[model samples]
Target: MKKIILIWFFMMFSMIFSETNSIYNTKIDMKRYPNASVVTLLDRESIIFNKDNSYIIKKHIIKRILNYKGKKASSEYKIKFDKRFEKVDIINAKTVKISKSGIKEIAVDKSKNIRIIDAPSDVGLMKYAAHKMEVIAFPAVNEGDIIDIEYTIKNNKKQKISGTVNFASREAVYNKVEIINIPKDMNFNITKFNWNTKMEYMDNIAKDRKIIKFSEKFMPQILDESNIPESLKFMPTVIFTNYNNWAEYRDELLGKFIKINKSKENLQILKEIKEKVLDKLITKDMTNMKKEEIIQDFIAKHIEIKYIDNLLDFEASSPKEILTRGYGTSLDIENLFLLLLKEEGISGEIVILGSDKLVWDDVKKGIDMNRFNYAISKVTIDNKDYFVDATNEFSKLGESVIENNIGLILDTGKPEFVNVKSIEKNITRIEKSYNIKIDLNGDALINKTIYFYGINAIGEREKYKYMTPIMKQQDYQKELGMISQNAYPISKQMDVELGSPVKISYTYKYTNFASIDGDFIYFDLPYRLDMLDLFENVRKYPFELVSDILRKNNISIEYPANYKVRIAPKSLEIKEKNMLIKRDLKIGNSNGGNKIILDTVVRYNSHIYTIEEYSKLYKILEKLNYPKNAKVLLEKE
Candidate 1:
């Protein structure tokens, strides 16, 4: 009887699966997809909304492996859900090896192979909630096999239906279908993203429900290449929302936030803590800037933060609870930050952050809240705006961790879109200076110093955060060996000061630094350059250079005066709208002796380039290739 009901339910959705008796029985033309690792025979999802506002999502997928890579890719997978809000049930899953001559079923114990984890496994899911992952392993998956999976996720409580539907997968998909059965009164809005495909959609309106269906015949694999930012959003996607008006949505979120933070007992406790914090950190005569810095620093230092994803779960503990516990999620910390600023007569509000402009392409029609996964506090002081992040101890006031600096301000009085320019900070730069003294045997003593500022300093701090002193020593010793195989570090020192550059100095003995034949010598100088091969061809998606940068390289080499440079020195300079490169190489004198000096500065004015602009910038980047400039040959006079 249950099987009959299940069959009826599947037929009610009306998904055309091309009639496969069994997953392993489906035969496909492998020649149609030459480079694909696997081919998906059927991919179907049905979202059914109940009259009680709850939704049930039933998903089924079947894939056939063509090679070893396909076998590995299909061997393991996981399904995630918030246990407190929803529950997931794996109806059935199996693996079978199919050949032209015969078919064999593999018996892998499901109870032994399935593992359930209550801890958060996906960064894209809620952090503090009861999020869980159910991992399944097809231990017998082999080449020329088929793996089938089916699952149903149902919400325990009724809530608005909100999620994204992607039309493509990691491998080629032969048949993909989506059916959404929504309550007529629910009125959810659908927004498509990165949609370059032309497909007809069916919207059938009935008595108490509205069904929207779409099926795609062939979807090529989405290539996972280098330099693609927010790669998931680049696919053909459909994002559904219930709130089309930003103001209404902002008010709803704000009301929820205030409700969570406005308990009488908690507010009283917060007031007392505020008084103590004010007395300890601020004076009556302090400037606003100083006060802002002190308050933000206190929050960042005192509250341990757990990061979250694009959508707010609203299930975390209140601000006062986290304040007393000395730990909190990002929302708790940011709320506390805003409350402290409010007590100081400063106004601040929480703003949801989007990764880049592409994610917010439908801002005019409707903003898909799913695109925004993180939130930060925006404060107003002296008629100027400051975006403060309480989750990162490395950033100062008005500094954001957002690489693109785009978000929506949740201002109740006048809610609006906010795009700020916080991309490049002057402190985020790298400067390196090298001094080398070569002996008659071509062995050189190299002294190098590097200064890291801004985001560069943050990166260095993070790299060394988990390392011990001995580990750092060993790492730096190995770092100098990149110059020559026989390099040995003589001395090294690193200094990290707050609000200053991270300085590193090292002196190494690089044996056989140059090839010498008694008359002629050849060597490549030590320099740093980021090669531009990611965008050698035109791409539909952009190649993301996440941050603007400035690099300065100064090299001074002292060699035998009897040897003359065989190659004539030349300076090359190229400037464009996005980048600039300047290289100067000349022969100088050191105490009447000969010294070779090279000063190069490369500056990137912008962080991102479109396909058309990337074509132009590719030519500019090609000119900065330092191979020709680094190679030097010297001959006896």
Candidate 2:
């Protein structure tokens, strides 16, 4: 009984394999040419079965032939096959004769063996046989199956070439992958070509036999060396290849060349340039001058940059060409700056640095040489090192542009470590004011004034370009609303004037004031709105951004002299390590009636707070929102 059971199991397994292994056949028919040769593919199937009972099957088939006019030319092509599942035998059988319709048929047995039963002629059959043998190989396939087919035409010219090949079953999925390989016999000149594989899957989840890998290659025609101009000699030669591991290969190649070509030659060129610049810049008349001033003047006047393509190559023109051309990339500017410094006999070095946006100091761990692209000039003035990027149109002298400050800088000349000085202490400030009067009907005629007096002004003006006119107006309204929410203005106007570093000033008029009970006055100040509640709720988050805020206000109200102060709000003042809030209200008799003035100031300097700190700080600010009392009474005239 046990022997019978084992035999039954074996038979079941064989039947399952045979059923899946059957090929899906398709035929392409072309009867225009009888003597024309053609090659056809049968069917390819993927069988997924572990050592256990569970298994999955996927199959693909293609049957197409192209008629080619006999032309004698050497060509290079490659054939690729997808192999995603366990091993299976690819059998090659004899081709049989079919009718003149160019239609060929294939037959598959119950055991899944496929045979090409019909073809146009025996020679066509021989060609098909050769293709079948040569094309059967293991292809790199993961999720799905792919077969790349390539063939060359040697000699064949009869009636139009046309024929059909058959795949036995229709159960398989077939795709024709592109072929890109130089034939061993062809002496073709390939300038550049890149080949990459793309994997396609039916679903987000990958299956053992679902990933299909296809490769594509791009080729450009080669030009004669004689026709190439003498000015362009520095062209880079790139070699791209496909392997099981690409990152490892890239590192290996970079390692091989980086050490040999990127060290000694680069350093020598930088040192030579530096000496020449120092000689030209330092003279007997300039002996008593400060190093910073000299270096600034030299960089501003001498460095001429021209920007071109990203790749570095040989150019007939020198730094003089850069000066003649006003526009250049950051690298070109840096190169020109270095060259000028060399000519002036100053000790300057070219340092390569990555742009700040792409390089993260913590994420990259140590510095990365591969990321470095832009160059900056490092000059020693008064025995102190200063890094300068003069490529920016409005950048201050000796200051690194924002984009180059945070990334890694490598001194290509001396290999000695150089540190970039911190310049965060530079701060910009803006000041504004408004003076106005309110009449008996709560109509206030006011002159609003604004002043910008720092680098921040320039930055703000530049940032305003990104906002629409309506948005800018809204922002202005919001800022003023913070001072007096109920103070609505009629017409608003703005004027901008540029000062040395940067300063802008704006002045406008405001009207409409709110008066309560025909005597008491009140205004909603959006900026004064209690933020303690919101801050407390969000304090538990990982990080908190605290805006640096400092505000002061003075308000004066006019009234009839007969009126007198009936009530006064309690003055409040609160202080902490990083925050301060103060409010004062005063009321007195004026010639018209009673004049009331309110003054308030708030300041916050901590820009960022951790979760725990924010939670505690938020609690303290929450208590500042307690309302105060203020009132006024009338006296007999």
Best by lDDT: 1
Candidate 2 local distance difference test against the native: 0.39
Error of 2 at 78 (Å): 25
What digit string (tens of lDDT, one per residue) describes model 2 on residues 1-637?
9999999999999995464333212342233223322222333333232323123333333322232321111011112221222222333221222345542333223143332222222123221122211122222211112122212222111111111111111112133222222223322121221222332222112433223223211111122222121111122121112222223322332243244334665456545545666556566566422433455455555644433222121122234444445434455555556544544455655555542332233213322233344556676655656666655333343334432233343333223333343233322223344444545454555555444332344455455545776886787677667656655545463434433234333333344453545555453221242352243344323332222444555556554454455554557887877667787877765554566666767665523344566666666655544343333343323
Query: Per-model C-alpha lDDT, please?
Result: 0.72, 0.39
lDDT of 2 at 534: 45
Estimate, for each residue in 104-142, the C-alpha lDDT of model 1 and write its tens digit.
666546689888886554443333646788888976787
Where does candidate 2 stray beyond 4 Å? 1-326, 335-365, 368-391, 394-430, 451-455, 461-493, 524-541, 544-608, 616-637
Q: Tell me the TM-score of each prediction against the true structure.
A: 0.83, 0.39
Candidate 1 — worst ten consecutive residues by lDDT sum? 419-428
Superposed on all Cα atoms, model 2 deviates from the true structure by an RMSD in Å of 21.1
